[model samples]
Target: MERLQKVIAQAGVASRRKAEELITQGRVSVNGEVVTELGTKVTPRKDKVEVDGVPIDREEPVYFMLYKPTGVISSVKDDKGRKVVTDFIDSEQRLFPVGRLDYDTSGLLLLTNDGEFANQLMHPKYKVGKMYIAKVKGIPTRESLRQLERGIMLEDGKTAPARVKFVSGNKSQGTSIIEITIHEGKNRQVRRMFEAIGHPVLKLKREMYGFLNLKGLNSGEARELRPHEVKQLREIVEKNKCN
Candidate 1:
């Protein structure tokens, strides 16, 4: 037996926090009885759990790594008829992107039906690094790039310290390519960070998430994550918790 919110989250109904809200709002029921208690525990195998009157099945979790192309939405569905990341995969289980990539940004995206797994990875405290290869306008000086390494202030707030490296540059063309790794999931963060340094991003593509990369996959292609890969990701999250 486990906490009701945890069970709901593990079943991919919602994140544990959202599950708690659903419980308090009287939207979650256990065996035909409305259960509004926060810490209620029930046998998941025996108890019938429903959210918003719809019973949730404890399906086996599925994970996929997709080479998300630029112009694809990192979502299960889109309202404006735009192509979504999930459209590239074939899966019966309801899968959602663990975290979102901007509609115009591309590369390494993960889709999964495990809410608990998704929550842990997406949580700010986890510190899972996401690396991006960005081609920006003007070449930034080392001093300017050091600001990013030391955490620069943004409109939202000061950003966390990031790992920035100069990959290549074209002094004649006034363009440069840099690799940046950040753990935060702020909206358009990579682009904004470069813009703040007076080097607006001309192109951006995520190169890695934690240790996972788009090693063999082509753009718009996807593959199931091996069991060990999933375990390694969980281990990374756990190690961060210890720190």
Candidate 2:
């Protein structure tokens, strides 16, 4: 038997967090009995489950890679009247983002209902590297690059050292595209780091997350992950356990 939330998530009914909310609201039932407890357990293959009076069936796992566009919030909901990331998803089954990309930033974002998988991706200790291509307002000097390599102090505190490199760009135009790789997922980290150095980021795009990339997928388009791709991703997460 697995946790009810896990069962619900595996069935693609909703995210584990949202499944818990459904349970709390008395919307979920197991074996024809309403269950509202957070820690309730049930067998997905044996027990019957339903949400909002609609029966849920076991479904094959689904994984997607989306090339998120800017001006959309990463969250499932926004209080200030803004479009959410879900608006871009047109799947028949329910799915949610594994992690997040800020509203102004864009690029590869994964969506899946596998709670265990999502846990591995979002857990801070994993140290899985994410690469970003950033265009900033000014060209960073060699010394500035050194400071970024060592790490920079944000409002929260000194950030972990990141891999920063200068790519080909026009210096006279006061703009440069630099590649940055960081394992930590702080709020607006790339932009914040550049701002700390007086070179604010003009545009940001996540080129890759761990082993996943946005290759071939057009902006605002999404595609299901191939079986081998999913297997490789799971292996990557397992090999790099979050400490």
Candidate 3:
């Protein structure tokens, strides 16, 4: 037997924290009996569990890739009254983002309730690479690009060297699109890197995280990841040691 919240999470009902909320609210029951206590235990296979009077199913895990749009915060909640990423999802299971994308930035974001999966993707020591397309105010000089390739001293310290390339630019218009791949997960790292070189990023979007891409997914839309896709992601994470 396991704790009720763990059972709920393992059954894909919600994240462990949200499951505990449901229990406290008297929304979860076992065998038709309300169980509002936090540490109540039950056998998932032997006892019938329900949330809001609906039976919970123990199915395969769910993973989702969402094309995040600008203006949506990446967190689960914002005490400052800003809209959050969860507002875009309508799943019965409580899910959280694997990492974060700043409110003004947009692109591929992963959502899952599996804590282990989330941990694997977020741990920086794993060096999981993420690719981004950045639009900057000025066309970066080759020297500036070289500086980025080597490493830049930020307020935090010198950043790790990243793979940087010039995709295209309109020098006449003083704007350029550059592709960058970095293994570290720093707060506003990409933007800061360009800003340090006097090329303030006007827009930024992550195109890929590790081996996962945002192909065919439109902004604000999401879908469950295929089993093969999940396997590929796991393999990539393991191979790259992203966590």
- Supply the global lDDT for candidate 2: 0.84
Ranked by lDDT, the better of candidates 1 and 2 is 1
Please give, for residues 1-243, the per-residue lDDT of candidate 3 as tens digits.
999988887765566767899999999999999999998999888999999999987765668888899999998889999888888888876678877898999998888867556666676666778899999998888999999999999998888889999999997889999999987778999999999999999999999987788888899888788899889877877877633
Worst 10 residues of 2 by lDDT: 115-124
Please write out the lDDT profile of model 1 over residues 28-123, one tens digit for every residue.
999999999998999999999999999999989999999999999887788999999989999998888988899889899999989889989988
- Per-residue alpha-carbon lDDT of candidate 2 for residues 1-243, written as tens digits (9 for 90 to 100): 899988887776776777899999999998889999998988778888999989886766788898999998887778998987777887766677878898889998888867557766776567678899999988888889788889899888887788999996786798999999987788898899999888899999999988889989988988889999989877777777733
Ranking by lDDT: 1, 3, 2
What TM-score does candidate 1 reach? Answer: 0.96
User: Using lDDT as the measure, which candidate wins?
Assistant: 1
TM-score of each: 0.96, 0.80, 0.74
User: Which sections of candidate 3 miss by over 4 Å?
Assistant: 1-60
| TM-score, cand. 2 vs. native | 0.80
Scored by CA lDDT, what does every candidate get? 0.93, 0.84, 0.86
